[model samples]
Structure formats: structure tokens, C-alpha cells
Target: MREVRNKWVFKKVKVDVFRVVRRVEELMRELNDDMSVAGEQEVCSEGGGRWLRPEVGWVKLNVDAGVKEGWGLGIGAVCRDSEGAMLWGMTEHRCATLEPSMAEAEAILVYMNKARRRGCSRIVVESDCKVLIDALQLKTKGRSDFYLLLDDIYSICNDFEIVL
Candidate 1:
């Protein structure tokens, strides 16, 4: 998808113009929606969203995961440095359907592990799931049924400096 946009694939040819345009437009919308740097807010700060940069030397990891009925789960993340240069991005499909919070928590934990391995000492991780975000912010895991998963996430988080 990045290749189609970044490499100017559209500029190379114009095929079935209207169909191509509509397809590209739909793809654009999906990508923008997938970026999900901020939830329930505009894409820019002036419009009340928060796709802001991290401090220099820090990487901002934007993550999101979703569970679709009968379709299992999808998890993805993109990491960009303070300069807005792409460090990495990934998407995965899990065949098993899982609870939403569990899937989101698992996604973030996986992203953090990858980021730490990528040598990102300081990171600002962003996610659209308010439940997971709120859970991570609290000092304790609480008495939720998924507390053990939360515990695992917190332990992995200790490997680096993290920003909510």
C-alpha cells in the first residue's frame, strides 16, 4: 500500500479512470482510518486530535487492534521517529477470535517487545482503545479477569521508557 502511494504508482498510469479513482479514494480512506493516531478526534491538533511528535530520540508507536465477528482479529502498529520518518510498520491476522480488550492488550505488548528489540529506548505508544489505555495508566492491574495479561504487559513495559 505504501508503495502504491509513496512510489507514485498512480502517476504511472491512468486505467479505467473513474473506477481507479474510486478505488484509490476508498483505499486512502482506509489507510487514514487505520493510522488511528488519535481516537475520536481530528487528525491534527488544531482540530483537537493528537498525532503530535515524540521528543527527539524518541519513537512514537501507533497501534490498533480489532476483532470482527467470525473473522478473527487484526493487529497492527507503525513506529515513527521524532522527525516523522518511518521506523517500521506491521499488521497481523490472528485466526482465533478473542475479546476486544485482550486482543488490544496483546497487540500493544507485542509492539512494545518489537520496539524494545528495535533499540527504541524511549517511546510514546498510542492506541485507540480507551479501555486498554485506561487500564495501562492505572498503577495496579485491578481485579479484572484479564489481570494476568495486564501483568505481562506491564512487565515488558519496564524494559523501556514509555509515554502514554
Candidate 2:
């Protein structure tokens, strides 16, 4: 990571007509820094999950995992600062059935990507699923379909620190 004047600088490129995802990540990091430095209103916080605060202004992202037998799956995430204020959040519902681990992973990916777009950099993600956390920690390979999702997650990881 290249740091210029205490700000991370990233090259932005346009692919065809659409922009790559990392640009959003960079902007999100900037937004988070500005909000924290300016002491903006609270957006969200770690409700009741494990979190690791490695930096003074780093944001905490809390995600919850839910599974439905026939209906599919649902995941919710709330991004907050150390002050316990909400910054941004999302609740995703996937119609396709998925394993608990996959659901958890997808949820984190979703939340992380969203946070990146919002300019969040120093982030600690909190989730309720221990299995998912362990898998991410162990860096295990998943199924083929899951592999693609994991790839996206891995690509964005360069933008933020993920906490289990």
C-alpha cells in the first residue's frame, strides 16, 4: 500500500464503461476517515459479536447469519465506530439455498464491499458464525461456486482488515 500524506493513494481506472470495484473501496476508506476525524453522527456499532479494534478510528462491522430451510438465507451487517454509532448497514436476502458457511462468507463479502464503497478502510468485521470465522482464518478452499465468491472477497480484502 502506498501512503501519501497519511492518505492511501490508489490508481483509478475505467474498464470499458464500468469502473472496477477497488475504486469504490478507496473512496469508502476516505469517507470513513473523514467521518471519524470530523466526529460525525453514529451510524452503527458492534451489537453483540466479537470485534478487534486495532486502530483509534477504525470502524467495526458486525454481521449476523440466518438460514431458512426452504426460503433461502438472510444476512445483516451494521457498520459502526468505536463510539458505538452506526455509519452504514445492509440486510441481504438470497433466494438460492446456501450452506451456513457460504451464507456467512457471502454476508461478509457483501458488507465489506459496501463498506469499501462508503470509503471505510480500517475495519474489523464481526460475525456470529464461528465456522465461517474459522474457515476464513484457515484459508480453506470451498466449492466451485463458493470459490468465485471467495475470490471476490479476497480481492477486496486488500482494501480493509477483516475481523472475525
Best by TM-score: 1
Candidate 2 lDDT over 32-151, as tens digits, reads 665567564533222332234335688888787677677678788978777554677677778978888778888989889889999988888777778767666677676777677777
List all candidate RMSDs to the true structure.
9.1, 14.1
**Global local distance difference test of model 2:** 0.68
Q: How many clashes show up in model 2?
A: 14
TM-score list, all predictions: 0.70, 0.62
Tens-digit lDDT track for model 1 on 28-78? Answer: 555455546444322453224656767788999989887877768889898
How does each model score on lDDT? 0.75, 0.68
Pairs that collide in candidate 1 are none
Candidate 2, 21: how far from true, in Å?
32
lDDT of 2 at 38: 57
